[model samples]
Target: MIPQLIFLIIAIAAIALFTINIRKIIRNINLGRPEDRSDRPAERFMVMLKVAFGQTKMTKRPVAAVLHFFVYVGFIIINLEVLEIIIDGLFGTHRIFASPLGGLYNVLIGSFEILAALVLIGVIAFYARRNFLRLKRFTGVEMTKWPLSDANNILIIETLLMIAFLTMNAADYRLQQLGAQHYITAGSFPVSSLIAPLLPNSESALILIERAAWWFHIIGILAFLNYLPYSKHFHIIMAFPNTYYSNLEPKGEFSNMASVTNEVKAMLDPTFTPEPVAEGGKFGAKDVTDLSWKNLMEAYTCTECGRCTSVCPANITGKLLSPRKIMMDTRDRMEEIGRNIDKHGKDFKDERSLLNDYITQEEIWACTTCNACTEACPINIDPLAIIVELRRYSVMEDAQAPSSLNNMFGNTENNGAPWKYSPSDRFNWAND
Candidate 1:
């Protein structure tokens, strides 16, 4: 009873902490400007099914995809065992589902053992891919210290949790062999059966080891739950909604800002009178909050897998641009602002903006606007949109465009074309 009561207290506290952190994340995501992604419910549902559940994009990289799939599937299936653990923890009942599940429980446990072993192997491979293999995508400039540490930490935690689970099973099996009171010979642990012979011979020692392993596995899971909000692993939860709400329009389509469009419409209509620009109102995004909510969500959804950057022409050509870095910078800035809001108030202003602070003009100008990044993104993250918005702010608000762009802008305004030649001279190029 005492043990059950202690487990119950820890579980409840973990639940509360997880809930609070998830709520805070949602609140922060809501800080961006409003966007309408409510159209086409059926299409969105299919997209979520294909991208999130099916993992269609991951198939592009076969080896990593297979390993990741096993880990993902194993993690989900292992949660069933966690459910049984929770029941036993609460009721002080050992092998609570053994009798009812019968032979099926043995099958499930055997499958879980197989999957757990595969998950362990997969995680090790992932660690090797990052650390030993030093994959370019994984070791990019944006992947500095914390991001690299976070990736390794998640893999280590997962490997430890799987080991603890197997160790606990092995100990439990040994206890069952010794005619222990609470330990049952119901579930088949194929992987742990090999481990059982290596455990301590004493019954009490085996029980102690089992208890320690059990506690470690559950507690580690709880810690990982809370850690996701602060880690790139948050995509495990956000990927579904992110894919569902992805921009479904043509890739070349640029979102027209309502304020700018209204101004342009007024200018085109001679009957319309120009309204005075409101003080502090900006033409384009100067900070994270100025971006649409979808753009902000894209930042949160980034896996930092660097697929976008791997295919990015700018990054390939040795330019000062990385689509992956742009998303990371955006997320970092948004997190900074969120922390500031938590410390002060929602209306509190940070003097630093996304432009010239988080991202530079050189990086912005490096993009070819080819939409390759957007196409390469597994979760439909559009870093290009953020780049465009920031560049728009630099041009329209600051008027700090480069000399080449300024000349093109001037030609477009006067000659109605981007070329220096007049309209009548346009046919001259064709003749040449």
Candidate 2:
């Protein structure tokens, strides 16, 4: 009766979590806009296969990558053992792994325990690098706005999982003492018959303890599942799609400009003038809606790991451009715009919006169009593109370019290059 009740509870909870979370995931996916490039059906399949299974980006940091991969595989395999434990606590039988493949099950469980330990140690190293060593070369001066809640939560989750494994091992040892068949595989999992001396002689107490541990483990998992979308763990789900759909083109290609109809007609009628596809046309993003859906996803998928900022040449060179902050700012602006649009209609405009007002013209131009940020990003965010778009807006529409840029533009119009030397200077270099 206890087993049946536990089974029903777990089934119901699992169903509820999947239903709620899956709906939210689908909604976020649907919000994505169409890409301007030609769609290739095969490209979608290739991307899905590569990112979901290949784990290509993780290879950037080999030690962390390998450790993470082990943890990921262990987490998945250990879930089967969790189900068996759940069943054993409720009923008299651990049917799932008790048959011919029992040896395989023991081996997997032992390996998982070892991998879990390694992951915990790896996470500790990561914390040390971020906090103590300060790893300024990889991470900037540590910015502690919220006291590392995500890291702490991950640690707590791992600790609880490790405890669950120990408890399961203890329960198994007790069962072996009570005349249950012991199967040894690879000698990795050392069965301690010593547990029999510690546990009560009565089977009832053993059953009760097993049931308690089972409840604790299952509940922990359910809670983790629900919390995933809200926490940094959301990257676990978003990372694949983000990488798969990442921009493959050069960072310099800011969207294609709309074609100008007639240069003469556009010049004659200033109001009716078609903005220069290269100049006056909508080059950079004017508002949140102006951003492509892929860009929007990039914002949401940021893990705030500071990996991009660490690799940024501009940040290294003492410029104010932090790639991580740029992504965050864009995300904040998009959410802010979304909230305002919701309160007012789509047509409603705020002329005095802080999104536009706070971000300066100079900061946008400081970017050197370096692809380092994009290359370093585990989720394939392109901060370089955002900078370029903003520069396009400043140059073409407002005519508010930097002095250097103004001089360049003037030279380009006059003699092609920004230099004051005559056009004949190009052939003069050839003679030399």
| True-vs-predicted CA distance for residue 344, candidate 2, Å | 7.4
In the range 390-423, model 2's lDDT, one tens digit per residue, is 6666776668888887988888878978876677
Cα TM-score per model: 0.96, 0.76
Candidate 2 deviant stretches above 4 angstroms: 1-33, 36-52, 80-97, 137-144, 179-209, 250-255, 259-282, 335-362, 420-432
Which 10 successive residues of model 2 have the least lDDT summed?
183-192
In model 1, the runs with Cα more than 4 Å from the true position are 272-280, 427-432
Give the clashing residue pairs of candidate 2, or none. 3-90
Tell me model 1's lDDT, rounded to 2 decimals: 0.90
Q: In model 1, what are the clashing residue pairs, if there are any?
A: none
- Residue-level lDDT for 319 in candidate 1: 89
Report model 1's TM-score to 2 decimal places: 0.96
Candidate 2 residue 261 Cα shift, in angstroms, is: 9.3
